[model samples]
Target: MSRPRTLTDWQALAARLTPQLQGNAFINDDFVPAVSGETFECLNPATGERLAKVASCDGADAEIAVRHARAVFKRGGWSRMAPVERKGVLLRLADLMERHQDELALLDTLDMGKPITSALDDVAGAIGSMRHQAESIDKLYGEVAPTGEQVLGLVLREPLGVVASIVPWNFPLMMTAWKVAPALAAGNSVILKPSEKSPLSALRLAALAREAGLPSGVFQVLPGFGHTVGRALALSMDVECLAFTGSTTVGKQLMQYAGQSNLKRVFLECGGKSPNIVFADCADLDRVAESAAAAIFYNQGEVCIAGSRLLVENSIRDAFVAKVVAAAERMQPGDPLDPTSFMGAMVDSTQHERVMGYIRKGIDEGAVLRAGGEDVAGPGLFIRPVVFDGVTPEMVIGREEIFGPVLSVFGFETEEEALALANDSDFGLAAGLWSQDIGRIMRMTHRLESGQVFVNNWAGGDQSMPFGGVKQSGNGRDKSHHSLAEYTQLKSVWIALS
Candidate 1:
């Protein structure tokens, strides 16, 4: 069906659409169960209903997928395809994604408990990424190294045989495309392991890839747990590159797995305790307040780059925090199927409890509860947007990556103090500062330890920018041509002229 027009229309469509569960591991262009025929339950977090029985793939399943990926990579069907030819196939996949937008968006909303509106946005972003990476294929050129007339030196980029993308359930479709598009653009066979919490859209994506003319064994979707399927991929010699977007703990574990096995190249986009600093500058407080609320509350505050730590200058801290709390109050949790819902349930019961624990820890450690820190009494895994005022930099909530809609507010006196508070965390994925002073913006961006800095905004950025971080936030860029190039290896050739 076409894009639903009204809220009623979307809600009605969601009601009628049942998840046509794909509960098998895909390999060599076909679906197959684990050797033991094991399966696990997939629940709808918003309603706490069983969505499907997903495949419980293990090391055996990973072996099957990896073997097929290796065979296809060596055969050079996708690996050696002409750049223009590969571009067309990816473009066709993008078109198919557009055609099936409604279904994909619906699956993500139902599976992960994100608002339908945000699910639609994620689906659209995924399609755009596919198209953008496709367009870049033919435009890329190999370089001729500068050398003497007697020598001809050439440098070319080639695919790194097989890439395994391990994506979290937070924004399933978008993150999967973030890794898969670039890996495929570089002409590598890809094995995608979507989070067991939400694997429906990824399963459906594999079907679209085959429909768009991906050759056999070039792509597969394995739905399983991190310990089994994820660890297996990290340990598989056939899987050359592992790209992951998850927590710092799991990211570290995967790195160890890589070291224990084949020493495969691992790129991790992990945890963040980003600081959102607001100053008493000559600017609009209302805009800053709204942006600050959305930064920590968007996606139920499950964002990796969420500005969880808010450092406000002492002069304007009270008024600014009040306005921010008011903005959050207006954005309440609602049914994920409802189009008007800006906030939805946590991804699962475990996450809901984890968030509540952090909120309690903040209060125990002397941070004042400012607003809306209670659990929503309902069937779904929902928590109210929480704000902890009078929070110090040493508080657990201020230092840890809670990964929920919980904000820790801190007061700072001067620029030096603000920088110190922002850079004190072990994680440094992103940081935001609200200031009109151009000099201050430039200085903060330079001095702050975060990888991405936003002067007056938070989280929304162009795909052309390389996205990743240093420190415990993990390394390696995810988006842009830089990511596409990372999936490939550089080969240098030299010839001596007679």
Candidate 2:
């Protein structure tokens, strides 16, 4: 595909696209509007221009959606479907997603301000997840207990009803698929609440789900503000379970709401302050430096598992920092529609301002600014990647979760100190360790307090592996056979015979 050259080209492409909010909410086999007939504007983050008007669903709309989901679950339209049958639907949905990959990717790029290439990759990843979940659906078996005296006991896994999924703005479409595909595969009805910042692709996914033979009300999409729609979903008693991918503060608030309302099952993938450690025995310094730059600069460093903290061994700290700074400087921010653009704007002005504020804070806190610390002047909210050296564990920039392309480098004297520094954070989503020493890899893998540890590489994982975090980073796994369990509940059956 050819790249868009100017703002007019981008706008022309967006104008030709039909926004998903034009479609109605798929509730109980019908496309319906919000109860209040309210709607909100969906903006293109790159240009701060309104793209479409989406339904601004509120508490009453959430209640209606949840009720329909509950009714469908109780009526056995989805929850009672055979595991194989559900798997077939999920696989079909995956196929449908593949069919619409280009459109979906474009929607994501326009709505979420991600580069089109990366958005296309996200669509492909979503398809892969659907197929992955389908493959594991029928193979998931419950334990069988041995009993004597002509008595038999069987344990079975059942679906959790009325799951409310709230996805993040960064990877909106991909995260929706992450929750929806697995939850549906496990035979649960879902009420998805896409982030207000970027809800177009998610709404589009809902339409596709219905087209792919998923029963109506089995999947519903609500687009609105988090304070209104998201809060309602979290506190709804009918929402038996909640799955969220967002900031730690919102995750915590949802947990409290779940606890206060019905103590619903809450699964969260929250923020991260992941450490990327570089040891002196690293195999390739150039590769490590490039990886370090990409680790914090990819997707504008909006990734929840982004390697923001760099812990380098003192022997090669100076050289590594210099190389990483040089690498980061080579990446330029431009329009998302430009295929050659390595980086794009932040999701919106708010996020853009937040990231810029963090950069200023880093400077004020006495961390040495290595490279690319200022916000770029453009119509879009673009901030250049920033790297800081002489960072300590206690500094605000070192401890806090800044979901942007900002890297903090700290020198470590020994492996013990490196491990300690890596683990010394409230968030433990993911960490990357660069070293050729087998013993060091083993030690760091065991010592690093993260859900995923990447050795040499960064953010390397498949749908077959579980993805999540420990401590304040939130609980519950996202991918693999483990995610299926999160959507299912086990029931024990006992039989007695004379």
Best by TM-score: 1
In candidate 2, stretches whose alpha carbon ends up further than 4 angstroms from where it belongs are: 1-12, 18-24
Instruction: List per-prediction Cα lDDT, in the order shown.
Output: 0.91, 0.87
Off by over 4 Å in 1: 6-8
Tens-place lDDT digits, model 1, residues 1-498: 567866687777766766456778888899888777999988889888888888899999888888989998898988999999999999999999999998899899889999999999999999989998998888899999999999999999999998999999999999999999999989999999999988999999999999999999888999999999899999998888999999999999999998998889998999999999999993899988999999999999999999899999999888999999999998899988788889989999899899999988988998999888798887899888899999887788989999899999999999999999999989999999888899999998999998899878888687788899889999999888888877999999998997
Candidate 2, 369-389: lDDT as tens digits: 999888887677888989999
Q: What TM-score should be assigned to candidate 1? A: 0.98
In terms of lDDT, the poorest run of 10 residues in model 1 is 12-21
